[model samples]
Target: MRSVWPLVLPVCSALLSANLSAQPTETTPATSAPEMPTEAMNSCLQASIPSAAATMTVAELRQGCQLLYEQQLQSAGESELQEQQVSSEDSTGDKGERLLKRRMTLEALNRANRFMLTPHKINYFFPASYTRTPNESPYRDNDNESLSDLSKAEADFQLSIKILLREDIFGDNGHLYLGYTNHSLWQLYSDADSAPFRETNHQPELILSFTNDWEFLGFRNVLNDVILNHQSNGQGGLLSRSWNRVMLNSVFERGNFAFALNPWYRLPESAQEYPGDPDGDDNPDITDYMGKFEFNAAYQRKDDIYSVMLRNALDGDNRGALELGWSFPISSNLRGQLKYFKGYGHSLIDYNVDLEVFALGIVFTDLF
Candidate 1:
């Protein structure tokens, strides 16, 4: 593959250079010539023809080009006629009408020029945010004074291959997303103070969606969604794991109100060996089952998006939890979110062990 890239690079570069070189010729027909049809152009356009007998006759080719050129001229004449009519209608109007007519003419010229010259565009955004926690939870029991002291900041970076696939194949609404995230605490605590806690996580998921605009069963926007996720914990084996999930979600929207319910299941790696115990004798291998339901509503249109969620599990025992969050878009490409979670669950832990946790964190997202 390494050797192939070097060979492939020049071929692609040459192709692009040829395409760029042809743009001027396509846009500007030589004034010195009579614009007569040529056999070379015909051959280039009809290279798929197996033989000269199958190619367009000289007379036919000439007639085709003449027809096309005449059609373009006729279209230009029609546009000029339309403009004249508009100017005549505005002649008896006020200054605003004259300005509007001038603007319309300029817009028409710009549109024509754009059709002749293809252009490319690029956009970029950056994200940064801070969070502060007021209470200590089981998941964040360190001596950190504020939430910012425990999980000081969050950052996200994302890039998307726009419209990588058409909407029809998967449905009318689908997105291809690629992203990376980083989270960390303030540099004041020792290793023991943050021991066994995850400092950073990396996630990337692809989503396919289908939706109906109208609400059914009192639901506003109804959507069917499927997601595949891969995640990694920056910690050691105890925290490092990856899983894949499939989900179906429905959303309802009416006026400024909206809500959603998401049901999902995850398949995790084989738990043949428990983390931190080489003997694998501490806990029995358990199958993991997961589900989630979420609701969201808009408010203030800025810095005040609120949402609530319920998550459940039955891997070894029954466990259920609830979460609430607020999120706001900081920029067209970035958003900041703060969320709080509380869980009552013996299922997430070993059957012999009981655990409870309350956690709060902030998330920053870069969307494309």
Candidate 2:
């Protein structure tokens, strides 16, 4: 049995070797690797693309990846800078709003003490007045030649202006101001001699004002001002008129109505060297008719304004003056005015002279 087994194994091995030798011998090339998962493929690309030189150079892939990353970083930086600029502009707008609020509050509290020369009263121009008095004309009357034949116009006109100097002086409740005002009577309609200025009165004043917050007798005190005032007509010979005074003014308000009381004491001036001279007190008895105190009252109803001024000696001598005025808006900053002045002292030249004047004009400013 052992001899038969060895002979059979030898025969099997010989047969297997003969069969393998009889078969053809050929080579088969390798195929590509199988696809990986999506995420794994991306990571593999990142890791292997830089080193896979047959597909692309590792250095070129690295440079492209760096450029892409740099572009992304630059876009992010620009977005961040734009956001910061918007934030800065918002901060500036907030600051401006706060500043505006503060300024508005200040104005509400102290409107009168604001700096700059704002107008205090109506400044206007008149084309004419009815009555014309040339009693104390600057032109002289001589025996040889009477100047009464001088060419004079019956119609007259006037102009006035006021300016301020200081505010909030000494304290927050006080103000100091200087003002110059002029009134001119022009004979515009008189064709003879081409019409000239018949009279021009110059008035200048210094005033110290204080806020008064007193309420009594149904009247609330609004302002109190002390004034050093001078008025003159710069004329020679018979037409000169001038005066100086220290005056006190008290203003009160109630609802839409306001009132002012002003009392003045005339300062003594040297008598003229000669009679009817230009440089001295032209009218010594001027106060007898002009009075010691004046009263002014004003009322406002919607867009309409009315005012009245009165002056009297209280002596029953039937002396003093009265003026009534009404104003209504004609435009945004302009108003049409109707004024009636029947009194003495309409001008320094007319201080001792009585006249009735009615005028229509535009008002650039208002008292209230």
What would the TM-scores of all predictions be?
0.41, 0.63
lDDT of 2 at 315: 73
Candidate 2 lDDT, 282-308, residue by residue in tens: 778778888878888766554566888
Query: Candidate 1 — which residues are off by over 4 angstroms?
Result: 1-166, 170-198, 273-303, 314-318, 326-339, 344-368
Write down the lDDT of every candidate, Cα atoms only: 0.32, 0.52
lDDT of 2: 0.52
lDDT of model 2 at position 30:
19
Displacement of the residue 136 alpha carbon in candidate 1, Å: 13
Q: State the TM-score for model 1.
A: 0.41
Task: Count residue pairs with overlapping backbones in model 1.
Answer: 7
Model 1 residue 163 lDDT score: 15
Of the candidates shown, which would achieve the greatest lDDT relative to the real structure?
A: 2
